[model samples]
Target: MKKIKLIFSFILVLLVAISCTVEGINEDTALLGTESSANLNKIFDISTDNSGKVTITPTADGAVSFKVEYGHGTTSSVTVQPGASTTHVYPEGKYTVKITATSISGATTEQTFPLDVVFRAPENLAVTLNKSIHNLKVKAKADYAKSYLVYFGDVPNEVGTPLATDGEVSHDYAVAGTYNVKVVALSGGVAKTEKTTATIIYNAYGLPITYELATQNYGIGGTFGGISTAVVANPFPTGLNTSATVWKYTKTTGAETWSGSYSPLDSPLDFATGNKIKLLLYATEVGKSLNVELEWAVGGTPANGVAVLKVANTVANSWQELVFDFSTIAAIPANAKFTQLVFRYDDSAKGSGEVIYIDNIRLTN
Candidate 1:
């Protein structure tokens, strides 16, 4: 009985010691760390710059260190001890900053806040010029620009206006002249400017060609003698103006034919509408009949595939203005390009070698 009682007492002492050790371990664990919502107050200094710089300073009770996360990169973080300030430079953007406060016992509490880094002025700005519908086409480009502004200088209406992101815009000048062009790239309302100058040329869209400009470009030629510059006859011929010069051609013996050929025009001649050729003629005899033919080119070869219209000189000897309506002839293609102008007079036996003055020969709408 005595030995059994001693064994039971030893077992009781062992159980009490084991219970006390477990309680001590529980107490130590409970004292390992503490967390409170007030730790958020540690974020005292938080600032950013338009150039993408951020500075942070955090302080908290019982905080051994801090982990600053910029939230731009998954593995981007910085570890700093308590009561210290750290800085990070980020790109211009909106971000969420996550700050983790770590206790001495390795416990951590995270606090996140919104961080905005504004944009700086755009960089590498450039401008290009083009033409559309007789207007100056301006296109601009830049790096890191949200939008652009174009100033077509000298025009009050378009001097300063916000433009699209693509930076493409068109402005028609009132006249042809040299003008300064300005382009500005904007980011967050900040601007970077560039300037250039462009000279604009006038385009005479479908305007009637003057007799001087025409004869110069097409060049007067044929079996007839070369061109001689002479003033128009007085009491001005029907189509002859006082200011215009006349083309004097004396007929040759062989065919009694004369013609003027034109180079391929800048814009192809449109014969769809008022396709008329007018000429002022002064012949030595009246009732002198002539064949005026219009020839067009197909595949670069002048062909008479369309009927040739000829208007006779019913009234002559004096200056008479005559019109040859190409529309009276067989249908030429609507957009046919006439390359050659032909004139033939049959009274060669009578009017042969007779000087015929041609003035103001022109093509019109």
Candidate 2:
């Protein structure tokens, strides 16, 4: 009986040894050899470009897959195969980048690196100014900027105000003068800025017009009949009191008329007496008979009272200021409020392909 008991104990010991060996093989373990540790630092490299784009390249012998996580809120993990690279774009801020490499045996090694991203300057920035009574409406556009800082240049020590892309802001100028405008683009906390200047003028007598104010409630080039008008740099010399740009009209073979219309005046223009219409005109030929007409509204509807005036171009190939006396032209109704202005060339008498320049059309009391 003692011999039988010893045999049973030997069998039990063999079974226990087998169970321990199986458990050791199946347990969760990690593979962190010297080669893997050294490769962990060498396999992963991170870099950023001027536009704040981040790229990560991983290269290791035993690495099977890679996982990268951006530290921002709700950011997802990026996975890539071994010997491959991944890229991501980040805002202007500092972030922690965590990268993990997984082996064939499900062993993972991770490393956290610091990344600093800075914002680039805004691109395609533009500003449009619209003038009104005692104020200027400014609109700005920047395609690449997330936010903006607008400076009206009205007061001192103005830190500026924040705006979004293609936003509009306004400033009130007490009198006519030159003012500075500055715009800044921001991403996260980093900023890049730009600036421009504006000149303001007030006309108290009549509806004022200038190159800068051409787009303010006004329309140009109507019924050209194959004529083209280009807004280009003023070709005239200084002291002509012309704005930076002038309207150059090129007539085609079938060109007949050129007209510019404005929005309805706030109040009816009283042209029954001493008012006159003035404009800067440049012609290529002398003695070109021209007919000028003003169309306006009566009681908020189109009126029949069209003021037609005749003028003779005595100066040839020179810039001259032309003033049409309303009193000398056809009689206008006492209640007529002038709004639209039309200029018709001598279609039957003028040559084809003739060019003319016009600027700064205004009215005077």
Candidate 3:
């Protein structure tokens, strides 16, 4: 009975050992027989900031690791695991990319893809030019532009000034004239957009004659009639006429009653707004009459001349503001294009060489 029991136990142990060996062999075979890599694909994300940066993510059906050949003159390839991405920078051109995906069983599949790294030209380019006397300010904006270059056109062979996307550039001309201004927008590559404009640089004489800019041509006109006028330093820079310079009028003895001074404007005045003219005056006596006249240009007939008379009621030897309302005159047309401004003081009366100061001549509603 003891021998039978021992034999049964031995048989059971042998059967158990044989079953474990067979299972181990099957597991090893299964591990070595993994499916080959298939369905190799990739996604590319290219940057728009002109940095030439590209992110590549590779995908495959049974891939455990991937080797990427950027094909842009790179010596070594990039190795990435499944579901991983790699970044590379390339110049503007076309290239081919090679991807090799490997499975757990050491089987690999290779695929090739075409890549294009082209920079598009900038679009919707807008340029603005602001002129103040001889200085010009330039501003530009566009889409897909990395930088800007401005050519003021005043210099020969201009290298152009570098400007940022949200910045402005200014240039001062030595002499006033018309110039062609050019601006170029770059895309960090060979792609570019350009714009050209004819800009006028001059001292524009218009309303609100402040007499501040030294470049302005404040040419005096009209009959002096013994009244001499000059732009001099403000002798009485007090009250409302505290400016650096003022128009001085000296009515000498034996001066005619029509003694006046006039200045020609650059363009015709538009009376679309209300006809009101204001000027700062410093007189020697009160109750003095001042006349403001508007006349046609040299080519126009003198029949369209218009005048408005106002009396000074403020204290003497002090600055005072006087408003001349031409609207009160019904004979003057509303759409008159007046180009000359004439100033007369104490018309139809004799003068004893009294001095008067004038400043801040402007139009108001």
Candidate 4:
């Protein structure tokens, strides 16, 4: 009986000790489960090199690991441990970032953050425009610009043409007028730089007044005491003058003795190539004097003006070629530019309602 009691007492003591150990383990587990993650925060560092690079560091009170969802696209999530950071490159836009932190006790906390990434505007924008008649060429350059857009401003609701930094764009206008040209520089983001300028398109007359171009503005008119002057079809297009058009001069009855007609040229006469002006003339009567003169539109004097007079007409009622030698006046100032051409007929007598036809006015050696 004594041996049996001692064995029972030993078994009861072992049971009690095992029960206390199990209770102590349960209490420790409950305390750990109650301690949840808190105070989750993040730090973001953006690069200044315009590369759109961002470094992110996350922290929490009880976090041991993290799962980061960048929320920009289909990019895979990143797994980061405590005291570590991750980096990502993003375009210029806004995004929402999701962060999931896991605690040591298997508890998780999640939060969403709003992120905005903006780019800087381009700087020091410079644009170059060149015009040749009706054609225009454009080019542009700027700091931090990736591309360019050009608006020719000739059409209504025009779409911008794309251009590269090292490239040029060309446009041909249909009509002659002034147009506004705009160039925009882009930085691959919302920021941009723009510039605007004006360009003129017209057909400029230089030498050899032919009156053949339909689009050319000849600036033909009568000056002082003449009746009128105009470009008309060749009344007698044969022999020396077979051209389709001719300049007609009408000397009204009883007009002044110095009555004349004039035409303006786009630029001053250039006598370097030739020193003679040749034209075809038609008259109703013989022995009529004709004069051709050159005068500056502004600041002109007798010293700089030049004239050539034909003593009498050799042919009557027919086309005759006449040459006016300007070599005598070539010694005038080299910079003297004459912009106007004057024609006078029978300067010594009053007009008797005489009409004259002229054609093929050109410069020759």
Candidate 5:
């Protein structure tokens, strides 16, 4: 009985001692000396406090100390008494952290923990053009942005392909007409297309238009030639007044000037009734003048000087358009078309070498 009692008591004492002892403490009854490195190292220590925090105290070699792996991802070690704590905030990612414990004795151990991190990308893109369509020569407008690409369509108003890579582009329609315009943008690997209506209108007339020249002396191209002499007959032939083609120049001299290739219309020019005419002239020399006149084309006939126009002395070789307002012709007996068109030069004065060319005689209503 005594032996059995002794054995049972010893077992009881061992159980009591074991139960009273704290985890990680040595069995020695000696007081804890300067903090130990071993006590400071705990990679992941479950805590009575919430919010993941792990603390490691440094060894006797120095203050509690430790480092983290994979970029300071895990908690560092700190040395202190029991139940002390620290915290670490880890960003979401795929990484591993190493928690190490070092004793004053220069011994160290390490542990690692895997971390998980995840995220989502961006959204779809939208694109627009300031102006989708415009006239040929007019400028179109487009606004710019990142990720989103804007594209113009082949036709107007239709959604086009990706354009961000290309930047804002312009299209000119070939003909004068209407067209559809479009704009599309892409973003975040997604394509978002938007469109607006546009038009190209051309209402203005094109240049280089054609016009008709009217005159009895008028032939296609230029100048009147090869016609019979209406001069001696009726200075003004019947049928040409008020036409875009007829006009007359009078002799500044005695109605007749050149002996060759030129002559007056008729002997009588009824300037008294209301006759109008225009002429451009220059002088050949002192005392000399070139008179351009319209009269009956008969030999030795008196010349009608009333319709003549002249400029003398300068002979500068300049030209001018002389207009005539024949509001009154007392009585035009021939019912004439005003058909006689002539260029007359009078050398009756000392200046004989003078010359003048006449063109473009138009009479309008």
Candidate 6:
């Protein structure tokens, strides 16, 4: 009986040992060296507005380790647990987003994809100036951003990675004339970008430029030349009709000017900004004033369109010089270019049937 009991005990011991060995072998599980595993399912998605901001999202919720790899050793990381997602933002550029996940089973996995970030370029860039010779500034705005990249030339270039929000810039012109301008903008790594160009013309006032000088019926000592800007009276009247005739002259410079009433004067000589325009007039005879009247025209208008500066004062023909400041003329509009000059004289009221003569009419610096 004792032998039988011992055999039963030995059998029990053997069964216990087998159970322990099987349990330990199962617990000694090998690490899933390959990324493929049900414990870890990693996924990544990237998107960008192209305006310098990019977003990245990953699938695989439980304790996920996230990261993004872009150009030049640039990488970022974050982690989210079980059945969830995470986000990341970046500036404009190309990128590779990566996400990693690990499970309670002690196994890990990872995935990667491309990402693009960028901004749109500027458009309809233009220029403006306060005064031709005083101040001029340039400005531009982009469709998707507050700032811009500025360039001056027939073509456009980004000065330094386009500015984030201040796309506006300015420059001053030393002399007056015309110029070409351009601008560029960047967006979406490579989407919706544009460049713009325009022409810029500058003119200054109060400069010493060539001008036309006109006069009415050549003065008393002059000739009785009738002039219509439309008709050029070749060989102006060589002889005066002995009797006095009303005369007029435009305030101009140089000898190219012809006494035709409709002919356009020499091209306007630009003046420096803030320069004042003065008119000098005198009577042909002493103590003989002919109620002088003056009118101003811009870009060659007829007798009345321009600002008119007239004085009805009786004068001593003895060279009465009247000074008129065109810059302050009441009838002349501001910012308009000068074109024509006119003069008329009436001596009948002064009881002098004698025609009046005028001379020394000028528009000068």
The runs of at least 3 residues in candidate 2 whose Cα sits more than 4 Å from the true structure, single-residue gaps closed, are: 1-38, 41-61, 64-89, 102-108, 132-135, 187-191, 204-268, 271-293, 298-305, 309-333, 340-365
Q: What's the ranking of the predictions by TM-score, best on top?
A: 2, 3, 4, 6, 1, 5
Candidate 5 lDDT, 288-362, residue by residue in tens: 343334444233233333334443434333334445444443333322222233443444432233344334333
- Indicate the worst ten consecutive residues by lDDT in candidate 2: 29-38
Model 3 Cα lDDT, one tens digit per residue, 1-365? 99999999999999999999999999998877776888899999988877788999999998999999999987689999988899999888888999999988898899999999978788889999987667899999999898899999998989999989999999999987778999999887899999999877767566777777565666535557888888889998877777899888888888999888877777566566657888888987898878888877344533445445565647788898888887787766666567888888888688788888888988877
Q: Write the per-residue lDDT of candidate 6 for residues 233-314, one digit (tens) a residue.
A: 2122223212122234321222122212222223342222332433323344444222222224455432453454445433
Q: What is the lDDT for 249 in model 3? A: 81
* Full-model lDDT for every candidate: 0.60, 0.64, 0.83, 0.80, 0.36, 0.41
Candidate 4, 191-292: lDDT as tens digits: 989999977665655567777775455554347785567889998988888889988888889888988877676655766567678888999888887888
**Residues 1-365, model 2: lDDT tens digits:** 99999999999999999999887765634223322412663232333223456676755558788788877665699888876777776667888878787877666788887777776666677777776645777677765567777887778999787777667777777765566777766543465657576655343323555556532433432544556666678887445644677767676665544432223443345555336878778887887756567676455433444476767777766777888777654455444566555566665543387777777877675
Best by lDDT: 3
CA lDDT, candidate 2, residue 279: 77
At residue 43, give the lDDT of candidate 1. Answer: 47
Candidate 1 lDDT (Cα, 0 to 1): 0.60
Using lDDT as the measure, name the better of candidate 2 and candidate 5.
Answer: 2
Model 2 residue 112 CA deviation in Å: 2.6
Q: Return the candidate ranking by lDDT, descending.
A: 3, 4, 2, 1, 6, 5
Q: How many collisions per candidate?
A: 0, 0, 0, 0, 47, 59
Which residue runs of candidate 1 sit more than 4 Å off their true CA positions? 34-120, 157-167, 173-175, 189-193, 199-201, 205-365
- Model 5 misses residue 259 by how many Å? 54
Single out the weakest 10-residue window by summed lDDT for candidate 4: 297-306
Global CA lDDT of candidate 4, please?
Answer: 0.80
Per-prediction CA RMSD (Å): 12.7, 8.5, 17.0, 13.2, 25.9, 14.1
